[model samples]
Target chain A: MPHATGKITARELIDLQSHLMLESTLVGQFNHFARESTDPQFGQLCQKLAHSRTDCLQRLAQHTNITPIQ
Target chain B: MYQDQVTDKNLCLAVINQLKWSATCLTGKILECEDEQLRQDYMQLLNRTFAEQKEAFDLAHQRGWYQPMMADQQMIGQVQSDTQKLMMEQQQSMSPMHQMAQYQGIQAPQGLNNYQQSFTNPNLQNQSIYVGGGQPYYSR
Candidate 1:
């Protein structure tokens, strides 16, 4: 019989959090760079990167039940 | 049961690390691109990769197989802190120049501000003036 234990491992939680944060930071940096960029191409690239990061954040959130830091 | 759990955890860690490295590569490419369009394209690709990585992370988490591969959190924290400090230093180095330019603009715009404000106002159409004493013209 499978026991319904609400407890989860601390290491797992930390690892999940760390990866999510790293992805979020990367996306934020891309967005910031995009906004600062004068070149249209670079701005577009930054936007794309920011979008990717946001997607990653969403997926991670879905998996871990972690709400994004708005 | 313990062995199976450990194996699953290791596998999840491996997948996560792979995704992390891929993301790092994308980040490097973004930093390297000089052309804005190229950078934008690469950033888009990076985003797609990040989405994939997130999916993988979520999959592992859902299965309850994820585990921290790093033994020392302090080391990672130190590196992150150092990176933040460097970024702050760079921003601070550039801020004074920006502040000076802003100050100059503000000082020079003492009269221009009022002129601009008047021109922008919709209700101030009756007070329009040209070089010559033209009639109060309301431009569309």
Candidate 2:
């Protein structure tokens, strides 16, 4: 059943949490790949991909309503 | 000889695969989700993933790192017909019991079933493992 209020269901929460983790890992990997790239254009492409992943991570994190623990 | 290191093409291919999987998963979740806002959010994410996947794929293709053969129309039509024939055969082969099971949603137990069992079983309660760290908000 769908949650009526602002709260999300457990399934949604789990999915969001997993997505956040996956996106975070991807962002890190892309950033590293960008840094290590020999080709300038490929480096730019990696950076762009990293930025996209960061945006996704932020969006997923926002929906989960959880502050990242330091 | 150069030392071993991950190539740009390999990284691009990995990213493309990840984005493709993300898009596929989001599509399935969007279809299953009944919540309007959640479905909208999933759709937006899926769109972004599709775009990112295309960008990565195009880059790889341009670099001649990921070239796929183009199938002719005849082969495509043959495959489509074959798939349709297979689907029809499968549908026709379904027994009454199979249909009844499907209607009642009786299916084989999945990993989630065992996971749920762990929570209910007293002996297994303490043994239940948690991944991704402890988060209070998500449990709410």
Q: Over 4 Å off in model 1, which ranges?
A: A1-8, A66-70, B1-47, B50-140
Clashing pairs in 1: A41-B36, A41-B37, A42-B36, A44-B40, A45-B39, A45-B40, A52-B47
Give the TM-score of candidate 1 (chain A). Answer: 0.72
RMSD per model, one decimal: 22.1, 19.0
DockQ of 1: 0.02
Question: All candidates' lDDT scores?
Answer: 0.59, 0.73
Report the lDDT tens digits of candidate 2 across residue range A1-70.
1234666666777776777777888899889989987778888988998998888777666565543334
Q: What share of the true interface contacts does each candidate keep?
A: 0.00, 0.19
Per-residue accuracy of model 1 over B3-105 as CA lDDT, tens digit each = 6452434544554575578578657656754544434544665677777567656756776667447658898899999999999999999999888766655
For model 2, the superposed segments whose C-alpha errors exceed 4 Å read A1-4, A66-70, B1-5, B72-140
Q: TM-scores of the models, in the given order?
A: 0.31, 0.61
